[model samples]
Each structure stands twice: as C-alpha cells, then as structure tokens.
Target chain A: MKPFEDVGARAVMILSPGDNIAVAVRDIAAGEKVELDGRAVVITAPVLTGHKIAARPIASGERVIKYGAPIGKATAAVAPGETVHLHNLTSDYLPTYTLDEGHEFLKEQHQ
Target chain B: MTIQAYLRNDGRKGIRNIVAVTYLVECAHHVAREITYPNRDSGAHLIGFPGCFPNAYSFKMLERLCTHPNVGAVLLVSLGCEGFDKGRLLEAIRASGRPAKLLVIQDAGGTRSSVAEGQAWVSQTLAQLQNTPRVEMAIDELVVGTICGGSDATSGLTANPAMGRAFDFLVERNATCIFEETGELIGMEHWMAERAQNPALGREIVNTVAKAAKYYAIYGHASIGPGNADGGLTTIEEKSLGAYAKSGQSVISGIIKPGDVPVAGGLYLLDVVPDGEARFGFPNISDNAEIAELIACGSHLTLFSTGRGSVVGSALAPVIKVCANPDTYKRMAGDMDVDAGRILEGRATLDDVGREIYDLILRVANGEPTKSEALGHQEFILTYKSFEPLGPACFPSAA
Candidate 1:
C-alpha cells in the first residue's frame, strides 16, 4: 500500500492504477491544484476529505472506476478534478436511498 | 501458540465460559433482562428470541447460541402462551451436555416471581461454570469472523484492507477465518469467484451474490445507508468493494448461512441474506444482527472495522474494534482497539496494523478484554428469518 504522504504530498489518493477517481485525503478547496499520476489537475469544486474527485474527464454513461473495479456509472459528463458523487454518479445494481427535506427516506432511481 | 480455553462436549473450544439467560419470546424479555441485571459482571449475558410466532431460523440460531462453546450453562425464560417451542429448545440445550433450566412466566407466577426464580438459576449456574474444564486451544482451532460497519471512504483504504491483511496472516497460520455480508458485496462476485477453490464453488459464490442483489433490489434499497453517503460513499457498489476488502486474498473454501458451523474451516463466506422471498424487512436490521449471525456460526470472536465508528460488542463473543478514520479514532479511542487510519496518515503501515490486530486476537483469546468488552458492551439481538440448507457445492473442500 502506498502511503498518502508519498502519493502527491497527501492531497488526494488514487487507490489503484486503473482508478479514474482520486480520494481527497484532506479537505481541498475549489481552484486548488492537486497532483494525480504526476500531473496537476485544478479542482473544479471543493472536495471534502474522503470524498472522490475525478482524476480525468469522464463521459456520461461511463463506468466510474475505483479500487480497479467499476463502482457505478456516471450520470452526467464529469470534468477532471470535479467532485464525483450522488448528483452525477449512480450504482449499476441497486437504487440508492437518501433523506428528504422532512427526514423521511426517499429512493433515488438510477437514470 | 496455545491459549487456555473452555472445551465443549462437541469438540469445539471457547474463549469464554458464559451463563446465558435467554428469553423464549418478547413477553419474557423483561424478566430475563432483570434476571441478568445483577449478575451482569459475573459472565451472565442476556440473549433471546423476541418473536411470539415460531421461526425455524430463529429457533436454530438460539439453539446453536445456547450450545455455543463459549456458554457453560443456559437458563430459558418463556412466556407460556407464545408459539415458540421452549420445551424443545431446553431439551436441545440439555442434550449438548450443558446444564439447562427453563422457567415459564405463567407457571413461575409472573414478572417479579419469574425474575427472582431466573436470578437464582443464573447465580447457581455461574457457580457451576466456575468448574468448567479448560483446555489448550491452538491457533488452528480458532474461528474468527470479520465485519465492517458505519463505513466510509477511508474504511476501504485503511481498516478493511488492514483487516484483510490480518485475515491473510491468520489463514496462513491455519486459523479458520470468515467474512460476510453478501448484500454489501454485490458488485464483487466475479472477483470473489476467481478465488474459490473449485469451479463449482465459484458458481455458488456468483449465485449467492446474485441472490443478495436480487433480495436487496426487491426491497427497493441496497445495503448502503444514508450514513454511508454522508461519509462520502457514492453507491452500494463502492461500499461493496470497500466491504469486500475484509476478506483478504484467502481461497474461498465454503459458503455457509446463519447457524451453519463450518465443517473444517479455512475461509468461509457467510451468506447473511435469507433464501427465497424477502420475508424479512432486511437481511440484517442492524450491525448487531450480523454479529449474532456470526456467533451462531460458532465464531469465537469478531474483528469489527469501522470508519464512522460503532460501539457494539456481542454477548457470545468479544469484538475488537479497528478504527479507519484518524479523526474518529481520536474521538472514540476508548472504544477502538486498533487505529488502522495510521496508514493514511503515514504513522504506520498496513502490515504494522495487521500484526497488531493478529497479536491482539491472541491476547483477547487468552483472556484479554477488548475496549468494548472492558466498557461493558454485551449487546445482543436476535430476530426472525428463514433459510434453506446449503447445497453440496457450497462446501467443495468437504465434498
């Protein structure tokens, strides 16, 4: 396992060689430049620690790869360094559930 | 290395000699709890089936729990009119060679009287348990289960994989290791199948995961929760890949369901999701349900990996908590056993944490109490579920 400190100075972590998303090791603000695979990518949006940031531009309907496997499919085109999450990516196998404004569970279908 | 352990009649060894106070139905739960209250620190634990209606799965689980190697005696509390077959359960417990007693609420004169009667039985049983024989238990005789709860992105990166490393170390030493939660392992079937010992077992792995996916799909929700999303996990597949890391790279030996003891353990995949229709609300209502299922399968202890953090320990076995996120570990260090998040911080390597976990297991097996155990976390929960027996392909090695 590569230590976070050795990987691009610990800003973000790319888990495996084929992973298209890098996990933010620490909170990163928008407009901050982070190194991925030795190349710097400008952050398009603020990313919280443990949240995913795109390592490369991804087309809509493309598989989002992490841990060298497909975690889900992109719902919209994603730019490099953009936050990748519920708003833009969805699981290929099951519907994800979240709370509504009233704190009741509401199911979000995969598009 | 060997540790002193309680030897059971069935040839299994245990790290604890606990007196179980079990309730046969929901009505008896209160009385049973009251009975165990005063004797709580004396290795007396409360376990029970709260359902009034009979369930084969619940009955089988409770019977196995009562006969678990960790238990030296059992006291059954029953509400007389419930559909549960308390008499048969008591008989099963007695047949296991452990001292067993039953108190029917209606027959024992209701609440106050039943609690008093149950407490007397527990006290006597605790005394009897003092004489339970101790034998040397080797590493190979150990059955260890691993689970991840309240997970986040760091869990996959830290605690889970570190646990996977510990599993590898244990499996290499000929110890029996089990990892489960097929519902959380939905997208990783093909990878897991590749590690199966045989082609047929590979097919069984795929089919088992397929069953879990179907079960969750029917419920219109995956195992990934709102806490998972809030913790930065995007979907169930992502959560699955993270959860799957706890299994390590051991060759898949067999697939067993709740209450099915592994014939000879190397590595076993526990299918927690029920068979047939989704009669139960979810495969596991909470993390404790999964822990109970692991105990029912004869696990001596469990390694629980968490990022968001969980503070639960099982009644039948000890739980060692591995914290994945450094921040959470700092906040809950008193409840956590290992700080796997050190890998991310570069304070320690995965192998370092893995060795620490393995050594801690031996210490715990030899009579060390984990953080949760020390804090008096004897959480227990059992609910209704259904299952069919395993097919021949589920255990290719035995075949």
Candidate 2:
C-alpha cells in the first residue's frame, strides 16, 4: 500500500470502504501534517484518538459518515483534517444525551 | 455438538446443575444471602429483586432464570407480604419438573428459621442434583447474548466488531445470538434494518429503535454513558455505531422484548426500552439489567465486550470478558478472557480474534470457568418495567 493509502501511516484508521471520516488511532496534535488518501491535510485542532477527523472537506448540513453510514450532520463547514465533534457535528436523529442537560427531563422521575 | 448436559423436563438442557436460592423481595435478601453464604463455592447462587411491588416483567425474568438450563433446583425466600407472586414462581418451577421449595420468612418463623430451612433445602437439593443425570446437549441448543459495558473508543473499533464476527459464526452454527440496548442503537436502525432476514422483521427492528429513541427523548437522554465521551465517542449515534458492531453481519431474525424467548435460531434484536411513555424512568439502570433480560430469553452464557474494562459476570450464566483497548487490557488482564485489543496494534485481524471468542464460548459451555466466574462475580439485577405482549411476528417460526 502507498504511504497515504495506508491510513496507519498517519495514525488513523478507516472503518468502511465508503466512510467519509477516519478515526484517529492516536492523539494528533493541532497543525500536525499528515497524508490521507494521497493528499496532504493539516490537523486543524487537537484530535484525540477514537474521535473522527474529516476525510475530506465537509459542507455545513452534510451528514458525517463513519462505519460507512451517516453518524450526524455537520453544523459548520469542516475542512479536511479538522476534528469533528460536538462543536462542528451534532446528531442528526436525536438530541445529545448529556448528564447535566438531561437532568430536566428526569427531574420529576428523580423526585 | 453434543456435550454433557442436565436435561430439564421443559426440554431445556442445562450446562450447569446449580441450586438457586432466591429472595422474593428486598426484605428477604439478608436471610437468602446467609443461606447461600456457606456454600458459596458449591454452585449455590443468590438471585432476587428488591422491590415489594409486583412487576410482571420481574416475575417472568425470575421464572425464566429459575428454569434456566444452568439451574437444577430453586429455593424461593419470601417476606410473605411483598406481592412478588411466590405461588406463580413456585408453580413455574414445578411445571418445569425441577425441585422447588418456597420458605416464607413470616411463616417459617422469621429470619433465623427461614435461613435454616433454606440452607437445609439447598443442601438436599444439591445432593439430589448430584444424581440428577447428565444428558447429551448439542451446540444448537445454546442461547448466547452480547453486551457492551464501560465502552471506550477502541470498543466499537475493535472488540465489538470482533464480537460481531463471533456472533455471525455462532449464528451460522444454529446458535441463538441476542444483541440488545435499543436505547444505544438510536440512529443506526435505518442501516441495521436492511440486515434483517425479511422486510417485516426489518421494520420491527426500526420500530424498536424508534421506540427507544422516543422513550429516551421523553427523559432527554440516550443510553451512552459519560465514559463513552472520554473514550472519544462524541454522540449517541457514534456510540450506537460501535455498539451495533456486536450484532455482526447476520440478518436480524426478529425483535423481542424482555422475557420474550427467540422464536427462531438467528440474530434477534432485544428491545430493552419499554413502549409508550417512559413511566419507569430509564429502561436499563446498568449493564447487569440487560444481562438479566438476556438470561430471561434463555441465554446460557453472555459475551461482554468492555473498552473501559467492566469486571462483572451474571448470577446463573458465565460471562466471557472481551477487552477492546490494549491499554486497559494491560491494566486489567486478570478480568478479561480475550485480548481483542491486539487488533488495534495490527497484530491480529477480526477473524482471528473472533475465532478465539467463539472457541471460548464452546469451552465455557463444556464446563470451563471464565475469569469472572472463578473470581466469584455473579452480579444479578432487575428493575421494574412494563412490556407489551408481542404479537405473532416477534416469535418467528422457532420461539
């Protein structure tokens, strides 16, 4: 495999043949340079391992694909190598289930 | 496929001949625990719910567990007025052709005598089970379930899919494999439905996930935990994608609610969340609750994949721990059964690890104690929830 074809060269892994994002296999520091699929993309932010990074430039409102399926929608245009998380990506199907934010829904149940 | 088994009258074959001492309510837990304490190493297990209010879901769970292929005899400890339906439980056990004894704490002269009677009954039952006769059981007779606990980034990427591979292998061999937690499968149902055996079953799969989404939306939460984010999952959908990996690539045969046995021997989605409005808070309070439901569906053992490392095993069933993260495995190797984290290092492939897990299942079925089992981790829990009776489609041809 070519250096870029091997995602492990950049410490990332692609799950599916049709995935639009690759998961960081190791923490990639901001501004780090890595070659993905034969193209150079600079890490735009500190991306932690197991988190998604845009495999290509994704437009706002575009669905983020992982494991060859849509995981969520991009809230803002995300450049390749940009970390895709809560800031730029939000769940397309349901609201995020956070502990603090979800307390209100369970207030009466807890009481 | 044939192995030494204890055949129950109901046609269910047990891999272990254990005497289960169960408390009907939380009040009788002390006496019940004391009864099984002295014989902790004798395959005498303590299992019960702590609620006094009668719950149909709990009733069915206990009934199925008492008659689980692993249990040979059952001793029910009742507080007398806890509304746990002791008569129904005893009747279910007797119907299965297993020896059952119910000791009411109120009538058995309270705590001391109840413990004494329960201990005597357990010893007698154990002695009887020693001669209960072992029959030949086949691999197709085993029911297994998969669950993810304390998930991290590596879980979905490594351990879960490996478990999925194992599930696929077991399913092909005609073993029943169940994967649950609809609340966790929130967003993957659309794609997941396509993997079903038929269009109707696919629709049922989607509806179950949708029901979970609706149920959790009422409480504004998903089944994803706090440790999930720390391990790199950003949303429930992302987490579900990982959790879904445990189902493997087999066609989902049907969707069944808690306590509903699989109608066929193929992949079945377990709908853990209840229908209608969420009246009973969150569906599954912890990982053990899901395991209990899996056992209720006739699971002889469970495959538990943990990315963050969970050291729990079930009361009546052995749990094979598959660790997803190499780092966590290094720290908690004693509790894990498979080093699935090796996949992350590129040292092993999915098929290689999957085969390892599949072999472990057969070995454990043949009387090998899992790490959790030998360490004495028999965590059993049941919470109150209401399940609507499933119609014909849910049972398929085999249930």
Candidate 3:
C-alpha cells in the first residue's frame, strides 16, 4: 500500500510539494481521529471531501496557504485542523464584495 | 520525425499557408465577407472584431492572427471612423513580411464601392501571396493549443487525457503548446503548482490560479459552468483537474497573459482572468474568447475536446475536435475530428486515440481544413476590458 494511504488517508493529495495542506480525499468528520505522518489529529470541522483545511495554524493578515502558497489572507486567525473557507478567509488582492460594496465600487469606477 | 514547414520573417514557422480578411469593426464586416466569399474556395478565411472601441488587447490579438504562421496575407476592412488603427495594424503585418492591404468603407464611397475595392485588393494580395515561395516546414515548428468546452465527466476520463497525450507528443517534438482558462483551474491550483519546473514557479502557478478564482467569485458566477454541472462536474476543482489534463504532464516552464507571444517552447498556462478589477464582466464570457487568446499567444492550431460536443473553430487557426462521449460523438461525428468516445466503446485505447489526434494535428497543419473551417465558421467577438501589465513574478523565467 502507498505510505500515505497506509495510515487510512484515502489518497495523499498535495497541492504543491511546499504546501503543508493535503485535501481530504474522502470526507472527514469533526473530532474524528485521522493520522498524518502517524500523528493523530482530530478533524476540526465537517470538511467536505474536496474542501480545504489549514495544514498549520495561520495568523490574521498572514497569507492563507494552499497548494503550499498564498491564495488569500486569513481575515481572522485559524487553527490547524480547522476548515479554511470564505467565512474566515478572504483574498487580499481581489477582495470579495457584498452587494452594497459592489454597487458602490461600480458607481465610483463608472462615475 | 520532423515535418516540412514554412518559416515566417519573424522567425515563426507555419504549418498551413492561408490568407485572412479582417473586418476592423462591425460596420465593414460585410465587405470583408464579400472578399472572402469569392476567394472562399481558396484557403482564405474571414475574421474580425465587431466593436468600435480601441482595445489594446483586441489590436494585439488581431495582429497576432494577421501574422500567425498559418496566414500568408491579410486584408483589413475598416469603417472610417472606428477606433481600430488600420495603419498600425497593416504595418505590423508588413513588418512580418506578409502581404497586407486596407479598405476604409466611408472613405472609399459606400458598401458596394468598398466591397469592389476589397475584392480587388484580396485578389491582388492572393496572387502575390501565391507567387511567394513555400518553405520547408516541420512538426517541431508547430504551435498547438488545446481547449475543452461544454465539458462533461467523460472529458477528463477520455478526451482531455487523450488530448494531453497528443500535447505530450507535440511538446516532445519541441512544438509550442498552450492550455488556458484559469477560471476553470480554480480548484486544481495546487495540483498545477506541483508540476511547475521550480518551487517559485510552482508558487507563481498557485498565485495565478488564485487570482482567477477571486475574479470569478466576485462576479457571482460559479467558476465551473452550468454545462459542466449538467455533465456531472461537482466543483471547480473537478472541472480543473479535467481541464488541466489537456495540458498533459509536461513541466509548466512559464506563464503568460493573453497576447504575450510565447518566447520559449514548452507547455505554458494562459492566465485568462483580467489583471485588475472584474469590471468588464467574466474574464472570458465564452469559449471563443479563450480560443482568441490562444491564437494571440501564437498557436498554429487548436485541439478542442468536448463531451457535450462543441463545434467551435477559430478564424485564424485550424481547430481539431476531439469528442469525449461515445454517444455525443455518434451524434456529431461529422462535426468532430476524432472520437475519443471510442475508449468507452472498447474499440480503441487512449494511446491509439492519442495517436489519431497527433496525426490529425500534422495533417491539419499541413493544410487540411477542419470541419468547422470547411463549414465557414469564422466566428469572432471582442469586448472592453482593462488589465494592468503582469507583475515581475508572472514571468519569473523570462528575465
């Protein structure tokens, strides 16, 4: 059996060799114990099969790591083993918009 | 293993010898068509943008098409007051040593007058272009691009990977290969980053995809399209994994934005998302927009993989359709080049289908018209958008 799978991880999916995070090949429930490098860490959320989680703890304003690089920044601190998603994270470069923000931005740009 | 090719003045080699008629704005499109219609039997194609706006990207893409290796000459049709700079565009073609002529409808008199003038110019250009000697071409001199549209689950399983194999073969021969639609690459960023030749490049790959995801997310559209969902794609990552498969397993040497002619030959990802705010709308509103970007990057031919089956081909380059679904191929064989669906039919191996695509690229590059070309599908559309130049990190290897 593959070394990553020997520990019951469905497949060892790496975003990049530099990335600390490996997406769950199968769904892992919160508090369920899964072994990484033989070290047991409980699932912090109901991470869907393909959604992302922190491979390590990230500080606010720090680059949110995925594929081993910064995709966005943590708007708030996130602990390792917790779900990293839109709720707590946002792209620093291309910021997400609420309806009001979009309206205001478009008005300013066009005006 | 090298095929014979024609090397252009700019040091690019052509697989096909073609003449193109370009309509600068929507107004002169008919005159451009008239010129191409009479010379239609020849390897001449009609291409143009419909907008009157002066878009730097549009000018750059049109310039690329006019001087593409496959094109031997160009005829420009202009409505006198429109913003497309015909003189500058013509000069670019002339600098490339290809025959080029321009007709301004308002200046020439009217529609009938312009059509007559355009026809005359095209005939003259065609004769001169024909008199130009053909040069030896090769498979290694080719620039090929692959794009998947209306993709379904079968795309990744058969068509995409099969096309990837063909890309691998092309890249092995030193042919330039391009695959794009970063919006589709949303979830597969990490998978793509790992394939970069270096760690920084790997990071750049991830950054490139992240930008695209953010661009699409702001527009309130799913990165994966509706057709993708109907075809069984669950998320952007799944679509990306399937889409990225068309690039084959080559190390992505560098990244380029649209209209940046490839300087090195290897598999490169085209960053399709606009560089700044998502003001003009979705990065690429449709598949042809993606196709245009590929051409702008110097693709001599395109490999189109479809599961639900798209029959789109570009005006500037030949598009080889590889259908992934057996049932779709069965329903659309006349519109397709290779039925990768045969893999599911149990009648062909992926390698066998790949070889078919490989051979098809050579044949199309050698002057065989694709089904879309034969059917006179020279569709083109360009819209307004702004982008800041790529950052230093975008082309880490270029320097």
Candidate 4:
C-alpha cells in the first residue's frame, strides 16, 4: 500500500481522481481539517457518517448528491467545509416525522 | 472439494465441536450452569428452556440440539417435576450414540450434590466424545442460515445486501442457505413471491408473511419497535425492505420449519411463525433465539448482520457478525467480523464486502473462530413457540 502524506483525518476514496467530494469515513468533528484533491478544506461543522458533503457550493433545495447520484435536497445553506447533517439536509422522497407533528401513526394505519 | 467435519451418528456434520449441558426447566438451571461454567473451554454449552409447562416444540428442539453435530455429548439436568419429556429426549440422544446422562436436582438432594454429579458426568461424556471419529464433508452437505437483527436503513444498503451476495455464492456452490422471520417479510411479500421458482411456492411465501403479520397484530407488537424508529426507519414496510435483503437474489426453493433441514442445496426460508393461534408472542424474542432456530434447522454456522451492532453467537454454531453502520462499526469493531460499512465510505464496494463475508464463512468453517465465539459469547435463548409442519407447496422441488 502506498502511504499518502498526512493532510488531515478526513475520509476519502479514489473512484475517480477528479471527483471533488469524499464521503465521511467516520464522524468528523466541527473543526476538523480535511484534505480534498490538492487543497485543504477545514470542516466548518460536524458531518455525520454515511451522509454526503458538497464538492462545491450547492444551492438551497438543490440535490445533495452521493454515490454520484442525488440522495436528498439541502434544507438550508451549506458551505464547502460545513457539516451536512439532519439539520441542513432532508431526503427527497421519504417524509421524516417529528414529535410535534405526529401524523406517522395515522399514515401507517391508513396505508 | 470438501472440508473436514465431525459427522454425528444421526448423519449430521458439524463444523465446530461442542459439548452441551441442558436444563429441563428453570429449577435445575443453576446446576446445569455450574457444570458448564467451569469447563467452558471443553465446548460445554449451556442451553435450556425455563418454562415448567410441557411444550412439544421445546422438547423437540432440545432433543435436536442435544444430538446436534456440533454437540459431541450432552448432560441433561432435570428438576424432576417439569413437563419436558426427558425420557424421549434421552432416548433420542442415546440412539444417536452420543454419551448423554441425566442429573435430577430434586432426586439428588439439590444444588451442591447435583452440581457435583453433573460435573462428573460431563467429564466422562467429554472423554467419550473426544474419541468420536471425524470425517470429510462437502459444501453440498452444508446447511447455512443468515439473519439480521437491530436493523436500520443502512443495513439493507450494506450488510444485508453483502450477506445476500454471500448467500448467492454459497447456493451456487451447492450449499443450502436460509433466511427467516416471516413477520418481518410483510412489505416485500410480492417481490419475494416473484422470486420463488414456481407460482404456487410464491403464494406459499406470501401466505407465510400474511400469517405472521396477523399473528403479531393479535399479539400486540404491530411490527414496530422503538429502536427501529430511532434508527430512522419509518414503517414496517420500510423495515421489511431492509430486512428481506438478507436472503440475497436467489430462487426461493422451499420453506421449512425449525429442525427441518433442506433436502438439497438452494435458498430456503424458515417460516418461524407458528400456525393456528399465536401461541408465542414473537417468533424470536432476541437475536440469540434466531441463531438457536438456525442451528435447529441444521445450520453449521450463521451470518449475523447488524446495524446497531449486536454482539452474540450461538453455543453450537459460529456466528459471523457483519457490521453495517460506519459509526457503529467504529465503536464496536472488536465485536464484529466484517465491516460492511466500508461500502458507504466508497472505500469498498458491495462486491468486496460480500466476498469478504463468504470468505470469512469458509475460513470459520475450516476452524477459524469468529470474534463472538472467541469472546465466549455463547448466548443461548429458547422460549416457548409452536410451528405447524410445512405444507407440500413449501418444497416443490423435494416433492
């Protein structure tokens, strides 16, 4: 195995070298520094494992792409280094229920 | 090409050598535990049903387990008043030519004397089993089972599909692979039915799930648990989509009940839910019960997938744990076998992890102990449950 120089402790893979964003291998603390391409992108916020990060700036409601496909839409603004999590991102197809608006039981029964 | 195995007198081949100590009811459980705890390394596994009520299902399962290929010997601990048919069970084990003895606590004047007698019996039995001959076995002779518990959405994407690929590999190699839990199959009934080799078998698959859903409804769980919701799965149907992926993509050859081994090599579903009224609340109370059932069906080993990360293995069979969630895997790598979480990170593909699981199974079968087994996690749980004999449609090929 070829050992790469230490850039930071961010998760990445080499599917295509030019692909900008790397999926988080482990949960990234809010202030962690990451190595992307040849540049350093310090994480502005925490990133949950299994969720995606933007290679470039994505507009609000724009698709948050993962696995080279769009998994969900951005609920709020996201920066290159900001943590993309449940707060700022949401699934495009499935409706996630919250405690306040408890219609989930009704939805299941009716379905 | 075949691997070496310990062939039992009952004609079953076991990958691991085990000595089983079973208590007939709760009263003699301590005596049974005392016998097993001190000699744990001798493959003495502690297994028993706690209820005093006589259950045919329990009696059958215990009999099958005592003479299981992995179990070279058995020591039966009886309270002297439980309803379990100890006579029948002893006959079954003795008939198999395995050394088996009974220690009745009530008759022996209770705990200390019973434990002393039980330990002596176990030592004698182990010495006899150590002399049992070994034989070479083929992959075609192997009956393997898989199950996923504490499932989340990521489980379907990574661990379940990875296990599915491994299942497909085993089936192609002429090994019988099984996945179970009809209650969890509710949403994928149609899809699962379509995969059956024949149309009648398809209907049988659907009927099994329908029966399970109805049973759970009456028993009051409604196919939902708080851990599932916390893990981000919304409904039973959604959970089903993830849970059903453990079967992989193979023609559903047959459906069988616990203790019923597959006649030939292919993918089979064990219809764990009972027929008629819901006698047992859930088909499996915990992951250990699921593994126990798998072992009962003659599985030499088990592939256990988990997203929340369960650390459990059967007493008789090695359980290879496949970790699904990256965060969970990071937290519990010591407890896991393969980290399928790498697929989500793009560091590894589904095929990579799938092959990893298959390779792990082969290695474990050839005498590589899994992490759970190495940790002495011989967790065994068997409660009361009833299952009807599978109908003719369940196994079209066999007919």
**Each candidate's root-mean-square deviation in Å?**
2.5, 3.1, 8.0, 6.9
- What's the true lDDT of residue B131 in model 2? 89
Candidate 4 stretches greater than 4 Å from native: A1-111
lDDT of 3 at A82: 70
- List TM-score per model, in order: 0.96, 0.93, 0.77, 0.81
Best by DockQ: 1
- Write down the worst ten-residue block by lDDT for model 1 chain B: B341-350
Give the candidates in order of DockQ, highest first.
1, 2, 4, 3
Runs of candidate 2 with Cα error greater than 4 angstroms are A1-10, A29-32, A42-46, A99-111
Model 3 Cα lDDT, one tens digit per residue, B1-399: 445566667777776667888999998888888878988766667888888978887888788888887788888889889988889999999999887888888889988988888887777777766655556676656788889998876687678888988988878878789999988777677778888877788898898888887777687545555566456444455566668779888888778888887776788888888876677788888888888888878888889999888988777788888998777887888999888876655577777888899998878777778888887776666666666676666566686
Model 2 DockQ, alpha carbons vs. true complex: 0.38
DockQ category of candidate 1: medium
- Could you arrange the candidates by lDDT from highest to lowest? 1, 2, 4, 3
Q: Model 2: per-residue lDDT, tens digit, B1-399?
A: 457778777777877778888999999999999999887678899899899999888898999889888999999999999988899899989999999998999999988888888898898889888887778777777899999999987888788989999998989988899999998898888888888777777788888888888887776666766687678777789889889889998888888888877755888888888776678788988999999999888888999999889999989988999998888999999999999878777778888899999988888888889999999988988889988888666655543
Model 4 - which docking category? incorrect
Find the number of clashing residue pairs for candidate 1: 0
- List per-prediction Cα lDDT, in the order shown: 0.89, 0.84, 0.74, 0.77
Clashes of each: 0, 3, 9, 0
lDDT over C-alpha atoms for residue A42 of model 4 = 84
Determine which window of 10 residues in candidate 1 chain A has minimal summed lDDT: A102-111
RMSD of 4: 6.9
- RMSD in Å for candidate 2, one decimal? 3.1
Question: What lDDT tens digits, residue by residue, belong to model 1 across residues B1-399?
Answer: 578999877677899989999988888899999999999987999999888899999999999999999998899988899999888999898888889998999998889999888899899889978887889998988999999999988888889888888999989988889899999999999999999999999999999999999998888879988888888999999999889989988899999999998877589999999998889688898999999999999899999999998999989799999999888998999999999878878788878888999999999999999999888899988887899999999999788
